[model samples]
Target: MTLDPEDSKLITLARAARARNEAAEGAAVRDETGRTYSATNIALESLTLSAVQVAAAMAVSSGARSLEAAALVTAGEGPSAADTAVTGELGAGALHVAGPDGVLRS
Candidate 1:
């Protein structure tokens, strides 16, 4: 699918986050106000949050009532249900999944 320049930029950010941490995944989201949030997966003994979940949570905590787009960069099959659910709750937008190379996977 063809994405606008902003969404493409989100993918780039997500890819960078993943590459920076050498983590399993990274994610970014654009809010209704055009603000963006980026995060990497957090897997700890006390807490575990997917990259997408963290990105969505960041938007929500930052007073974003809705999202315009979301993206995840991972080597897995696709994004998790938690990711989709968060996006659906915030807004009816597609979940763009990309590989480490910034190629959209889903």
Candidate 2:
């Protein structure tokens, strides 16, 4: 698929997060203000969070009121229901899914 430059940037950011952390999943979100946030999945003994959730939280904590788009880079099929719910609450318009190879899947 031909993605907008901004969307492509999100995928690049997500891929970098995954590579840097050696994590199973990474996610990036673009807020309404055009700010982007990226994060890797958190999987500690006492806490677990999907990459998408972490990215969304980062956007929110950084004072983003709404989301314009989100991207996930994972070997898995797609983002979880919880991930969608969080982004939906933040008014995300699109959720882009990409493989570990950085190829857009959906």
Candidate 3:
């Protein structure tokens, strides 16, 4: 079946996430939340996101990626133009994360 852009994106994200998770599992880097994150860690987290969770994760990850990309740029080690373009297209902005928390009774 042909998928919408969102679905296509989600599928790509899911596949990438699964691959990253597998790599991380092999490396045993599953509990490094307080330490330096491996590339697998970052990729896995970003890829494993569902369409529903994309917004929040993207909000945080997008900022982090931007910061990282900027640092790389300054250090003369930034991603190539194609990388930037692809990453820009995949920013968390593509997800829907906002919704009502709950209904309050008066």
Highest lDDT: which candidate? 2
Please give the distance, in angstroms, between residue 2's alpha carbon in candidate 2 and its true position after superposition. 1.0
Cα lDDT of model 3 by residue, 1-106, tens digit? 3434433333344334435554321110111121111222233544652222232234345343321210011112223454344335434222111111211111
Deviation in Å, model 2, residue 40 alpha carbon: 0.3
Q: Give residue 67's error in model 1 in angstroms.
A: 0.5
Which is the better candidate, 2 or 3, if ranked by lDDT? 2
Question: Where does the lowest 10-residue lDDT sum fall in candidate 3?
Answer: 25-34
Ordered from best to worst lDDT, the candidate numbers read 2, 1, 3
| Clashes by residue pair, model 1 | none
**lDDT for each residue of candidate 2 in 1-106, tens digit (9 for 90 to 100):** 8999999999999999999999999999999999999999999999999999999999999999999999999998899999999988999888999999999999
Residue 90 error for model 3, in Å? 16
Which predicted model would earn the best TM-score?
2
| Residues 9-101, model 1: lDDT tens digits | 999989998989998999999999899999999999999999999999999999999999999999998887888898999993778898888
TM-score of 2: 0.98
TM-score of each: 0.96, 0.98, 0.24
- Number of clashes recorded per candidate: 0, 0, 0
Minimum summed lDDT over a 10-residue window in model 1 is located at 92-101
